[model samples]
Target: MTSSHRKGSTEGTNRVRDGGAVHVSPLELDITWGGDGRYWRIDQDRRIAELIQVCWLEVNGSVEMHHLQPNTRYKLEFKIRLKPDAFGWNDSPVYIMAMPGKGTKCIWASADLSKIRKGEQTCSIPSRLEFTTPSSSVADDKMSFGLFEIWKGRWKGGLVIEEVVISKV
Candidate 1:
């Protein structure tokens, strides 16, 4: 008999293998910053890179969607935390984009970044993109998703991104 680990395997997907999902690190993503690149800094702590000093207050990243299992459900989870000095995320919602099959879907998520108590406690924010793979095939075969909302011309800063996870549901 085949081992359980070998059953129900995601053979054709790059995001999964041996019943395990792929976790994308934030540092690996394409993060846009202000002119001097000084607007953002990759803070290394215990080998963990936290995208901090994000004055741009934005995250634009993409991955190949065609590698997902067709007709299956998945969740695009963004793992992030707010620093003590974080600002400008209160009145607006973070935006995400994805293409499960044939069409593109946009999602908006909100969090209380201002209320996070520094030193006393740490808060984690999860921005999820829940979608179902299309039997017809994913359009463009690529998915672009991130955190950013245009409210004004001013710049905002101080959020930490741990990683981005693509999990089967």
Candidate 2:
């Protein structure tokens, strides 16, 4: 795993055992107020982003389609953990949005974090947002994706983001 920052933006890449996976650290994501210490606590040493509290939630990222194996299927997931005292998730629904590449139709899927128990034990299970890549590479190289809970306008807290993984299915 390796991570770097460019112009205040974070980018990370990690190789999984399958040799076709990319692990994107939380710091690499375009998080709303991610750089602000008041709303997010970024621990460079641990390579994790912990959300202190926020009303407008948005965590976005992208990767070059070329980096992935051609004609392959993949699933995108966020590795996260909720503190025992986490709150404001009772009614709000978070959605995962993805666009395989430019000019492609965007897709959305709900990630039900509501039923997940808050604790260290449940952290091992990742919050999944499934999307398959295009069967072949397209003219546009970038595939944009994100996690959002903005519609509810609810203040949520105690969410810790480890990384987002893109792996072959």
Candidate 3:
């Protein structure tokens, strides 16, 4: 797959750190759901970008974006709320499968972050997620990119997501 990138001070790719040195935004997201309420604006929360100091969202609901890199290598670190025992706020959240409509897939997944860290290049893996890029994750002939279009249940009273980060390999 080609390394599709957008250059500019875009909403989720800008990072000015340590006296104006701009670093590439290695992480991005469309956080439609989480512990906090959904916010359409980028300046509202940190759950939006788990790493690389980019855009973040701290809420719960639905979010959608397009032009995701297709049939390629990628990495995502997410701290998702797991299925709490009989709790309404429980969230063993599964990232909304970014299938043909989004041109992507999920290859691997693990709620454990330590394992994901073995190959991650930047940022620490979150202890709350299991992610993958395999096409057979949910259904055949499909792929899952960490776009987070859907979240199971709600983050009514707990920390929605501790962190989330993603990169195209």
Candidate 4:
């Protein structure tokens, strides 16, 4: 956790791991998935979830962001992987979005899940997502921050989400 205090941003005494304050949180047990349990599976031992296949794509999980320092530059990252037998990522890129406080931001990633190698521990290569947190304000003191998998009408699947991380950049 590197110190996230921007040069001109507000500062406070909130300790974090790594260089800045970094929070690595595993996904919750009850993750919101599309098509109920048909399209996804949870590996309780590894604490990760895999998206098998579905007509549409939508996966979401949230965590409290109160521990985030005000006015600090933070990146919300999602740890993911692509299974060897995965499909449907070559046609179009998947959309990843994060909502911090009252603001939201979106980013795009390669749809080619086949290119990613498998991880030794989990049998899937690990991928990361980094997005900035919304600037804080008095009114939006209560912020619910999380990552979501959203794509347009298409066949989307084959994504393994291990965890979500919030760290100062």
Candidate 5:
């Protein structure tokens, strides 16, 4: 993957668009939603759950940050949800991995996603989050990090995700 580092602004920020193909920030890794099973959504039980068709595609991108002080960790959080009236996470953690110096495989560092307790159909909560990025000391070549939907150790249930954020650890 390629990266473009910009001057200033170490704090991770987001830019929102209305429609069409996505736009990427000059300094951030561009993660695209090409050919992921996410497009095939499961229908919610109409009698018990509210049928919500998400207008926004949600946050989509990569964790390849340029200008990161070599070895320093960058943490990211993605807030999500499953059902409208649902409250609780899948009891699973998010998995994060980094590839040092343009490697094909990602070195694993996990980001555990918390539960969804608060109500905010139009807002994001920290509980329902995928926590990634750690204060690391493995910087040698350009590093890249990201979280995965599936974790290795446990079984997952429920839904997680509402919004996303990126920052330094």
Candidate 6:
């Protein structure tokens, strides 16, 4: 069996490794209105965040490039699930975006949560918003990423964010 250790922390961001993949708990993300009990319910025991209600949905996270293997491709994704009574996602399109650092081009990938929900027959609603990490010229650059659905002005709820997983591709 293999075990991993906490690499260290920067501004409350603690990087943990599972093999070469980094698992970022929901508590590490910068979720809008996350501190409000009315909007979000954080379960520390489960290490997940559940959305009660929100008009603007913006969940963002970042990691230093040095934490990942250099010159290698990777996929960043959010491991999430939608409650059965989930609302406000039919027309609103959520996007998963990523950028290596400042002044770099941001890559976007449309996340179809509804499609995933419809296709699954089981009670499990686990889904992912995945994006390919853009290569950076500087090895020490910080990579910023997020799942956004703020443009439509829709009120959404029933989102359960498990964590952000970044793994080599």
Query: Considering every candidate listed, which one attains the maximal TM-score?
Result: 2
How do the residues 1-169 of candidate 4 rate in per-residue lDDT, one tens digit apiece? 5321111112322225676554433334234443256767666577566776765555444444566666666655556776666676655555444555554544433334445564523322223444555555555343344433345456666677766566766
Q: Write the per-residue lDDT of candidate 1 for residues 30-138, one digit (tens) a residue.
A: 5555222355565434312343344345565555665566777777776666666666665555565555533656654555455555432433454456777666653
Candidate 5 lDDT trough over 10 residues, lowest sum: 47-56
TM-score of each: 0.67, 0.84, 0.31, 0.62, 0.37, 0.79
Which tens-of-lDDT digit does each residue in 1-169 have in candidate 5?
Answer: 5322112123443343332111223223222231223422222232011212221222224433343434444444444445544422345445544453453455554433354453444333342222323344334334444435432434333343333444444
lDDT of 1 at 105: 65
Q: 44-118, model 6: which lDDT tens digit per residue?
A: 788788888888888888887667765566777777777788888888778888775666678787766676573
Candidate 5 lDDT score relative to the true structure: 0.36
Q: Could you tell me the lDDT of residue 90 within candidate 2?
A: 80
By TM-score, the candidates rank as 2, 6, 1, 4, 5, 3
Q: After superposition, how far is residue 9 of candidate 4 from its true place, in Å?
A: 32
Candidate 6, position 88, lDDT: 85
Model 6 ranges with Cα > 4 A deviation: 1-13, 118-140
Model 3 stretches with alpha carbons more than 4 Å out: 1-29, 33-72, 79-93, 96-102, 105-155, 160-163, 167-169
Candidate 1 accuracy as TM-score: 0.67
Order candidates by lDDT, high to low.
2, 6, 1, 4, 5, 3
Clashes of 5: 10
Better of 3 and 5 by lDDT: 5
Clash numbers, per candidate = 0, 0, 29, 10, 10, 0
Per-candidate Cα lDDT values, in order, are 0.54, 0.74, 0.31, 0.51, 0.36, 0.71
For residues 1-169, write the lDDT of model 3, one tens digit per residue.
Answer: 4221221123545333434222333224333322222322232344222221112212221112222233334444444432222122223432322233234433433232222322224434343333333332222232223433133433222123334334453
For candidate 6, the per-residue lDDT at 75 reads 75
State model 3's lDDT.
0.31
Checking candidate 6 for backbone clashes, the offending pairs are none
lDDT of 5 at 162: 30
Better of 2 and 3 by TM-score: 2
lDDT tens digits, residue span 1-169, model 2: 3222222243335444457788777656777777677788888789788888899888888877876776567778778889898888888878887787776788878866778889875343335555667777765577788888998888999888887778877
